[model samples]
Target: MGIDELREWQAFDSVNPIGNYRTDLNFAVLAQQIARWSGHCTEIPSLKDLLVIDPLPLTNEQRAIETAKADAARSQAYTQSLIATLQSRVKRK
Candidate 1:
Protein backbone atom coordinates (compact mmCIF):
# COMPACT_ATOMS: atom_id res chain seq x y z
CA MET A 1 0.00 0.00 0.00
CA GLY A 2 2.80 2.42 0.93
CA ILE A 3 4.78 1.71 -2.25
CA ASP A 4 1.72 2.08 -4.41
CA GLU A 5 0.84 5.37 -2.78
CA LEU A 6 4.39 6.63 -3.11
CA ARG A 7 4.43 5.76 -6.81
CA GLU A 8 1.12 7.54 -7.30
CA TRP A 9 2.44 10.56 -5.42
CA GLN A 10 5.56 10.61 -7.56
CA ALA A 11 3.48 10.43 -10.71
CA PHE A 12 1.42 13.37 -9.57
CA ASP A 13 4.42 15.29 -8.28
CA SER A 14 6.29 14.75 -11.54
CA VAL A 15 3.71 16.88 -13.27
CA ASN A 16 2.94 19.25 -10.38
CA PRO A 17 6.47 20.03 -9.17
CA ILE A 18 7.32 19.42 -5.53
CA GLY A 19 7.96 23.01 -4.38
CA ASN A 20 8.14 26.50 -5.87
CA TYR A 21 7.90 25.57 -9.55
CA ARG A 22 10.89 27.59 -10.73
CA THR A 23 13.19 26.94 -7.77
CA ASP A 24 16.63 25.41 -8.45
CA LEU A 25 16.05 22.35 -6.27
CA ASN A 26 12.73 21.65 -7.90
CA PHE A 27 14.17 22.02 -11.37
CA ALA A 28 17.11 19.78 -10.55
CA VAL A 29 14.88 17.05 -9.17
CA LEU A 30 12.53 17.39 -12.14
CA ALA A 31 15.39 17.16 -14.57
CA GLN A 32 16.79 14.02 -12.94
CA GLN A 33 13.35 12.40 -12.84
CA ILE A 34 12.75 13.30 -16.48
CA ALA A 35 16.06 11.84 -17.52
CA ARG A 36 15.32 8.61 -15.70
CA TRP A 37 11.76 8.44 -17.05
CA SER A 38 12.76 9.17 -20.64
CA GLY A 39 15.63 6.74 -20.57
CA HIS A 40 13.40 3.93 -19.17
CA CYS A 41 15.97 3.55 -16.41
CA THR A 42 15.28 3.22 -12.71
CA GLU A 43 18.78 3.83 -11.33
CA ILE A 44 20.86 6.93 -11.88
CA PRO A 45 24.59 6.55 -12.28
CA SER A 46 26.41 7.68 -9.11
CA LEU A 47 28.29 10.98 -9.01
CA LYS A 48 31.56 9.08 -8.66
CA ASP A 49 30.75 6.88 -11.62
CA LEU A 50 29.83 9.95 -13.65
CA LEU A 51 32.85 12.00 -12.62
CA VAL A 52 35.57 9.35 -12.23
CA ILE A 53 35.32 8.00 -15.73
CA ASP A 54 37.89 5.58 -17.13
CA PRO A 55 40.98 7.56 -18.14
CA LEU A 56 42.02 7.71 -21.78
CA PRO A 57 44.92 5.60 -22.97
CA LEU A 58 48.19 7.01 -21.70
CA THR A 59 50.88 8.47 -23.95
CA ASN A 60 54.30 6.84 -23.86
CA GLU A 61 55.66 9.63 -21.67
CA GLN A 62 52.71 9.31 -19.29
CA ARG A 63 53.16 5.53 -19.15
CA ALA A 64 56.84 5.94 -18.30
CA ILE A 65 56.04 8.42 -15.52
CA GLU A 66 53.46 6.05 -14.04
CA THR A 67 55.92 3.16 -14.25
CA ALA A 68 58.55 5.24 -12.46
CA LYS A 69 56.11 6.11 -9.68
CA ALA A 70 55.20 2.43 -9.19
CA ASP A 71 58.85 1.40 -9.12
CA ALA A 72 59.65 4.07 -6.52
CA ALA A 73 56.75 2.89 -4.34
CA ARG A 74 57.99 -0.73 -4.50
CA SER A 75 61.53 0.32 -3.68
CA GLN A 76 60.34 2.34 -0.69
CA ALA A 77 58.34 -0.64 0.62
CA TYR A 78 61.35 -2.95 0.24
CA THR A 79 63.58 -0.49 2.08
CA GLN A 80 61.09 -0.20 4.93
CA SER A 81 60.88 -3.99 5.30
CA LEU A 82 64.70 -4.26 5.37
CA ILE A 83 64.91 -1.54 8.01
CA ALA A 84 62.26 -3.35 10.13
CA THR A 85 64.21 -6.63 9.92
CA LEU A 86 67.42 -4.91 10.94
CA GLN A 87 65.68 -3.18 13.84
CA SER A 88 64.33 -6.52 15.09
CA ARG A 89 67.82 -8.08 14.88
CA VAL A 90 69.33 -5.14 16.81
CA LYS A 91 66.69 -5.48 19.54
CA ARG A 92 67.52 -9.19 19.97
CA LYS A 93 71.28 -8.48 20.40
Candidate 2:
Protein backbone atom coordinates (compact mmCIF):
# COMPACT_ATOMS: atom_id res chain seq x y z
CA MET A 1 0.00 0.00 0.00
CA GLY A 2 0.95 3.68 -0.28
CA ILE A 3 2.45 5.81 2.49
CA ASP A 4 -0.87 7.66 3.00
CA GLU A 5 -2.83 4.38 3.43
CA LEU A 6 -0.20 3.06 5.87
CA ARG A 7 -0.35 6.31 7.87
CA GLU A 8 -4.16 6.15 7.99
CA TRP A 9 -4.04 2.53 9.24
CA GLN A 10 -1.47 3.47 11.90
CA ALA A 11 -3.65 6.38 13.06
CA PHE A 12 -6.70 4.14 13.29
CA ASP A 13 -4.79 1.42 15.16
CA SER A 14 -3.43 3.94 17.67
CA VAL A 15 -6.87 5.31 18.58
CA ASN A 16 -8.67 1.91 18.65
CA PRO A 17 -7.23 0.19 21.71
CA ILE A 18 -7.38 -3.62 21.90
CA GLY A 19 -7.26 -4.83 25.48
CA ASN A 20 -5.30 -7.95 26.45
CA TYR A 21 -7.41 -11.12 26.07
CA ARG A 22 -6.60 -14.85 26.19
CA THR A 23 -3.29 -15.50 24.30
CA ASP A 24 -3.69 -12.02 22.69
CA LEU A 25 -6.57 -13.50 20.70
CA ASN A 26 -8.33 -10.13 20.24
CA PHE A 27 -5.33 -8.69 18.39
CA ALA A 28 -4.97 -11.83 16.31
CA VAL A 29 -8.64 -11.78 15.28
CA LEU A 30 -8.41 -8.10 14.36
CA ALA A 31 -5.31 -8.82 12.27
CA GLN A 32 -7.07 -11.66 10.43
CA GLN A 33 -10.06 -9.46 9.62
CA ILE A 34 -7.79 -6.69 8.34
CA ALA A 35 -5.80 -9.19 6.26
CA ARG A 36 -8.94 -10.68 4.73
CA TRP A 37 -10.27 -7.25 3.79
CA SER A 38 -6.91 -5.97 2.46
CA GLY A 39 -6.15 -9.25 0.55
CA HIS A 40 -2.78 -9.48 2.34
CA CYS A 41 -1.78 -12.32 4.66
CA THR A 42 0.20 -9.82 6.73
CA GLU A 43 -1.58 -6.62 7.82
CA ILE A 44 1.69 -4.70 8.11
CA PRO A 45 3.96 -3.86 5.18
CA SER A 46 7.79 -3.98 5.24
CA LEU A 47 9.15 -0.47 5.71
CA LYS A 48 12.10 -1.05 3.33
CA ASP A 49 9.67 -1.45 0.41
CA LEU A 50 7.36 1.44 1.37
CA LEU A 51 9.72 4.22 2.46
CA VAL A 52 9.13 7.55 0.62
CA ILE A 53 11.74 10.29 0.20
CA ASP A 54 11.23 13.97 -0.52
CA PRO A 55 12.83 14.63 -3.96
CA LEU A 56 13.27 18.39 -3.60
CA PRO A 57 15.14 20.11 -0.76
CA LEU A 58 16.39 23.50 -1.82
CA THR A 59 19.49 25.10 -0.29
CA ASN A 60 19.40 28.77 0.70
CA GLU A 61 21.29 29.74 -2.46
CA GLN A 62 18.93 27.72 -4.65
CA ARG A 63 15.90 29.29 -2.95
CA ALA A 64 17.32 32.76 -3.45
CA ILE A 65 17.99 32.02 -7.14
CA GLU A 66 14.41 30.83 -7.65
CA THR A 67 13.00 33.91 -5.88
CA ALA A 68 15.20 36.18 -8.03
CA LYS A 69 14.09 34.44 -11.21
CA ALA A 70 10.43 34.84 -10.24
CA ASP A 71 10.93 38.51 -9.41
CA ALA A 72 12.70 39.06 -12.78
CA ALA A 73 9.84 37.39 -14.65
CA ARG A 74 7.27 39.61 -12.88
CA SER A 75 9.36 42.69 -13.61
CA GLN A 76 9.69 41.71 -17.29
CA ALA A 77 5.91 41.23 -17.53
CA TYR A 78 5.26 44.63 -15.91
CA THR A 79 7.75 46.31 -18.30
CA GLN A 80 6.02 44.71 -21.28
CA SER A 81 2.63 46.00 -20.07
CA LEU A 82 4.02 49.54 -19.61
CA ILE A 83 5.49 49.45 -23.14
CA ALA A 84 2.17 48.35 -24.56
CA THR A 85 0.36 51.20 -22.72
CA LEU A 86 2.89 53.77 -24.02
CA GLN A 87 2.56 52.44 -27.59
CA SER A 88 -1.21 52.73 -27.32
CA ARG A 89 -0.91 56.34 -26.12
CA VAL A 90 1.46 57.12 -29.01
CA LYS A 91 -1.01 55.63 -31.49
CA ARG A 92 -3.79 57.82 -29.99
CA LYS A 93 -1.62 60.95 -30.60
Candidate 3:
Protein backbone atom coordinates (compact mmCIF):
# COMPACT_ATOMS: atom_id res chain seq x y z
CA MET A 1 0.00 0.00 0.00
CA GLY A 2 0.98 3.64 -0.58
CA ILE A 3 2.00 6.03 2.24
CA ASP A 4 -1.45 7.66 2.28
CA GLU A 5 -3.23 4.33 2.67
CA LEU A 6 -0.82 3.28 5.38
CA ARG A 7 -1.47 6.56 7.23
CA GLU A 8 -5.23 5.99 6.99
CA TRP A 9 -4.83 2.50 8.40
CA GLN A 10 -2.72 3.94 11.25
CA ALA A 11 -5.39 6.54 12.03
CA PHE A 12 -8.05 3.86 12.21
CA ASP A 13 -5.82 1.69 14.40
CA SER A 14 -5.17 4.55 16.83
CA VAL A 15 -8.88 5.18 17.41
CA ASN A 16 -9.77 1.48 17.49
CA PRO A 17 -11.09 0.79 21.04
CA ILE A 18 -11.27 -3.00 20.99
CA GLY A 19 -8.72 -3.17 23.88
CA ASN A 20 -5.18 -4.71 23.75
CA TYR A 21 -5.57 -7.99 21.85
CA ARG A 22 -3.79 -10.38 19.50
CA THR A 23 -5.41 -8.67 16.51
CA ASP A 24 -3.74 -5.38 17.48
CA LEU A 25 -0.37 -7.10 17.60
CA ASN A 26 -1.13 -8.78 14.28
CA PHE A 27 -2.02 -5.44 12.72
CA ALA A 28 1.19 -3.89 14.04
CA VAL A 29 3.22 -6.75 12.50
CA LEU A 30 1.34 -6.39 9.23
CA ALA A 31 1.97 -2.62 9.24
CA GLN A 32 5.70 -3.18 9.74
CA GLN A 33 5.76 -5.68 6.85
CA ILE A 34 3.82 -3.27 4.64
CA ALA A 35 6.26 -0.44 5.54
CA ARG A 36 9.17 -2.63 4.44
CA TRP A 37 7.43 -3.42 1.14
CA SER A 38 6.45 0.23 0.51
CA GLY A 39 9.96 1.14 -0.76
CA HIS A 40 9.55 -1.28 -3.70
CA CYS A 41 6.11 0.09 -4.57
CA THR A 42 7.49 3.53 -5.54
CA GLU A 43 7.66 4.03 -9.34
CA ILE A 44 11.06 5.40 -10.45
CA PRO A 45 10.88 6.81 -13.96
CA SER A 46 13.32 5.72 -16.67
CA LEU A 47 15.57 8.20 -18.59
CA LYS A 48 13.25 8.22 -21.61
CA ASP A 49 10.22 8.84 -19.38
CA LEU A 50 12.04 11.71 -17.63
CA LEU A 51 12.99 13.36 -20.95
CA VAL A 52 9.38 13.21 -22.10
CA ILE A 53 8.07 14.45 -18.79
CA ASP A 54 10.41 17.44 -18.47
CA PRO A 55 12.04 18.47 -21.72
CA LEU A 56 14.36 21.02 -20.10
CA PRO A 57 14.96 23.57 -22.82
CA LEU A 58 17.44 25.93 -21.18
CA THR A 59 18.30 29.33 -22.58
CA ASN A 60 21.82 30.09 -23.88
CA GLU A 61 22.65 32.01 -20.68
CA GLN A 62 21.42 29.17 -18.51
CA ARG A 63 23.42 26.63 -20.53
CA ALA A 64 26.55 28.75 -20.20
CA ILE A 65 26.07 29.00 -16.41
CA GLU A 66 25.64 25.20 -16.10
CA THR A 67 28.72 24.57 -18.27
CA ALA A 68 30.82 26.93 -16.11
CA LYS A 69 29.63 25.15 -12.93
CA ALA A 70 30.51 21.73 -14.40
CA ASP A 71 33.94 22.96 -15.47
CA ALA A 72 34.60 24.32 -11.96
CA ALA A 73 33.57 20.98 -10.41
CA ARG A 74 35.90 19.09 -12.82
CA SER A 75 38.79 21.40 -11.94
CA GLN A 76 38.12 20.95 -8.21
CA ALA A 77 38.06 17.13 -8.53
CA TYR A 78 41.35 17.15 -10.52
CA THR A 79 43.01 19.32 -7.86
CA GLN A 80 41.81 16.95 -5.10
CA SER A 81 43.11 13.89 -6.99
CA LEU A 82 46.50 15.54 -7.53
CA ILE A 83 46.71 16.36 -3.80
CA ALA A 84 45.81 12.74 -2.94
CA THR A 85 48.48 11.37 -5.32
CA LEU A 86 51.14 13.63 -3.81
CA GLN A 87 50.14 12.61 -0.27
CA SER A 88 50.35 8.90 -1.21
CA ARG A 89 53.81 9.39 -2.72
CA VAL A 90 54.99 11.15 0.44
CA LYS A 91 53.63 8.27 2.56
CA ARG A 92 55.46 5.71 0.38
CA LYS A 93 58.82 7.52 0.76
TM-score of each candidate structure, all chains considered together: 0.41, 0.41, 0.43
Which has the greatest lDDT? Answer: 1
- How well is each residue in 1-93 modelled by candidate 1, as lDDT tens digits? 799999999999988757543464445556666767798767874333333223256789998999899999999999999999999999999
Best TM-score among the predictions, by candidate number: 3
| True lDDT of residue 44, candidate 1 | 71
lDDT of 2 at 80: 100
Clash totals for all candidate models: 0, 0, 0
The list of candidate 1 runs beyond 4 A from truth reads 1-55
lDDT of 3 by residue, 1-93 (tens): 999998998898788634455455555556556656778636543443323223377899998999999999999999999999999999999
Error of 2 at 18 (Å): 25
- How much is 22 displaced in model 3, in angstroms? 48
2 against 3, candidate with superior TM-score: 3
Q: In candidate 3, how many Å is residue 86 off? A: 0.6
Angstrom error of the Cα, residue 66, model 3: value is 0.1
What's model 1's lDDT at 8? 96
Output the worst ten-in-a-row residue range by lDDT, candidate 1: 46-55
